[model samples]
Target: MGASRLLVSGIACLIDFDDAALSGPPASAVPTVRSGVDLLIEDGRIVEVGAGLPAGTAEVIDASDRVVLPGFVDTHRHLWLTALRALTTETDLGGYLESVAGRLGPRFTPDDLRASAYFGALECLDAGVTTVQDYAHAMRSPDHADAAVSALEASGIRAVFGYGFPVFSTARDLVDIRRVRERYFPADDGSLLTMALSPMGPSYSPIESVREDWKLARELALPIAVHVGAGPVAQRPIATLEREGLLTAGTVYVHANSLPDEELRLIASSGGSVAIAPAVEAQMGHGAPMIGRLRAAGIGYGLGVDVVTATAGDMFTLMRAALVTGYLGAGSRPSPADVLRAATLGGAEVLGLAGRIGSLRAGKRADLVLLRADAPNLLPLHHDPVGTVVSSAHPGNVDTVIVDGRVVKRDGALVAGSLPAAREALLAAAHRIAG
Candidate 1:
């Protein structure tokens, strides 16, 4: 846990909205940007945010010439593939599956899983992503699952660890899932770690297996994260779920690149959300990014770094991809404000964590990022902070990052763990697995 700290005298872009406004579309919620404001955090929660707040006993951190905002939330990411960065840059969807899932994924040891997950979480923290939905689908054993969870806890990032079934496994039973659930994530105890069920949906699994997985998720009351519209399954996945009466709230559909408008409407009607990885979809030929389609259907969607194997693993790159592809596909560019909202609050909403970690308001977790306004790429932050962030900013400009009232990255470097050790471990594991 981190000590109480006061961030003062900065330009803060609070992507805040009243809890009553939760029923409205996420795009309709406006942000409140203010200058020379102060935020007081105590006991891992924001206590007050306004002008001339009393610092009292808290350590005052000078946020002078910085742009303070809520930390980025990555809605969907395969953390286990971090060591395989750039391996799929020139591959299509089938190529990716054949190379990674079919070849390398089966060779990972528990130690390798720990190294990849820990380094991946650290990379995210260094890039100012405080919260991430780790769609872990590479579990080979219960030991592998334990290693991944332990690595996330040791890295100090707020994560929803989606307990996924193995990619190539044929067993459809819940024995392993039940064991992991009971051992690691029995309930939502307000810790930094939570759990979700990442199953191969109808597109990849049979109807009977999908039904059993959904039933197990409901029995445990955990959220569901599944892939839809990516593979070449003939039957419509959403329609199949609806026919089986398995569509429910708190489900995060990943890579809905090929899903039609009717399925988008069904997701919105069912109170579900989406996690879009624009760069990956374009590179891997999953299809076009669904920003415009999600907006047209009035569904809330969050941007993600699907896999570092195909694209850069940062929110800034994903934001830029989302902006350009949105314009190219829809013929209308989305505003920078809307895109930034999707990176912060919209991502939180997708992960079912808006109430605790999305916006920088009173009574929310103190997960914040401070960007250096003096960086060459972001110089003269002239009257448009959100635009600068969405258009020009990168990971190098992230000066400080705080998660749960704890400062993880300070002075442009990660401070929570030994990154050099993590890097060496990752390299060793990568070489071993590649061989």
Candidate 2:
């Protein structure tokens, strides 16, 4: 009667994102088909996958009308900015900075950050996003960063906590990096909550500061992500970083909207990955990112929602926007399946967690979402399964979600976290900060 209260069984269709795992171009597995597979989860790792299991194994769920998929992994976002929604609706990049830097940046109380981070987290979970890379740049105070992580942990969402500059500034402050490392990177589970030092880069921080941050990241073996692309007015962060020897295997550069062609190859050579938030880039006037060229250059590329300000958290929407817009930019050459690859497995590659999560294989983590193929807007299913997921699916169609072998959502419901309180708290925080 209350929240299924049991283990789940039965699976109708399992569309593995492993469509091109072995053929070369950073592929997923294979055989995306109507699978009558049964999943067994115990102590977190996926214990079994294949035909039916023995009777009375646990609880049984009727999954005949559902299509299962791996939970979406979002590579980048400022989840804590959930409270400060659209403060720059009528402004540009400078305006976004002025508003955030001057007002909301200094006003992010612990409670405010907690509320905002939780609010954003709820949206992602509701839309079937299992993992999010949270760039909490406004963490001026230690409590602020702690609050953000606390909110994420409380939300029961998996995350990579990007320990960034305080108040979104580029300047480096003399803070306790070890404290941050110890707090998030617990020895028990090294993968869940990670500590990544993010600098403001050339524009915000001095070249020395950026380089120092890179060195520290390298020493700690933590991946470094920075804002690149956006435009050509200033030396693009990617080129500047490459020239400075900061672009290394540890670098995970974000954006590159207006980067030159050769720069993509440079990125690949440097062993860095590219994160393309196509929708946010277009809306924010950064022009189109060269996704096709980046892919061809053997650089791992993934999609980002950026923030709730300019894009939705649903990876499907981000993937759809990228598919159509990138095709339009390239005059519709790449197949929609290629776009889906970027969203799922490609993203997994960028995050460096491809083998364990990402796709639905026997040994992979059972992170998946169940979408309703029979929705009125969805109509007849004639197109490619991945294409339909990319172009047509929405959060509403995500009827169920499984993360880390646990049912996080079932029958259009959430099994972790709450939004009403988050919304209320963030709303109050915004008004208080603005006032």
Candidate 2 residue lDDT tens string, 209-279: 77788778767677877777534323666677768877677466788766676777777887778878887
Q: Which candidate has the highest lDDT of all? A: 1
Give the number of the best model, judged by TM-score: 1
* Candidate 2 Cα errors over 4 Å, as ranges: 1-10, 19-31, 86-90, 166-171, 188-191, 230-236, 330-332
Scored against the true structure, residue 165 in model 1 reaches a CA lDDT of 64
Could you give candidate 1's per-residue lDDT for residues 1-435 as a string of tens digits?
A: 578565544454433434455553554446667777788888889888888877778878778678888999999999999999999899998899999998999888999999999999999999999999999998778888889899999999999999886777875447878888898888788899999999988889888888899999999888999999834553578878899999998799998888888888889999999999988989888777688778878888888999999999999999999888887664235778777888888888899998998788888999999888788998778667777888999999998999999999988989988899999999999999985
Positional deviation of residue 410's Cα in model 2 after best superposition, in angstroms: 2.1
What global local distance difference test value does model 2 have? 0.70
Q: Assess every candidate by TM-score.
A: 0.96, 0.90
Name the weakest run of 10 consecutive residues (lDDT summed) in model 1. 9-18
Q: Give residue 162's error in model 1 in angstroms.
A: 0.5
Model 1, stretches more than 4 Å misplaced?
A: 9-20, 27-29
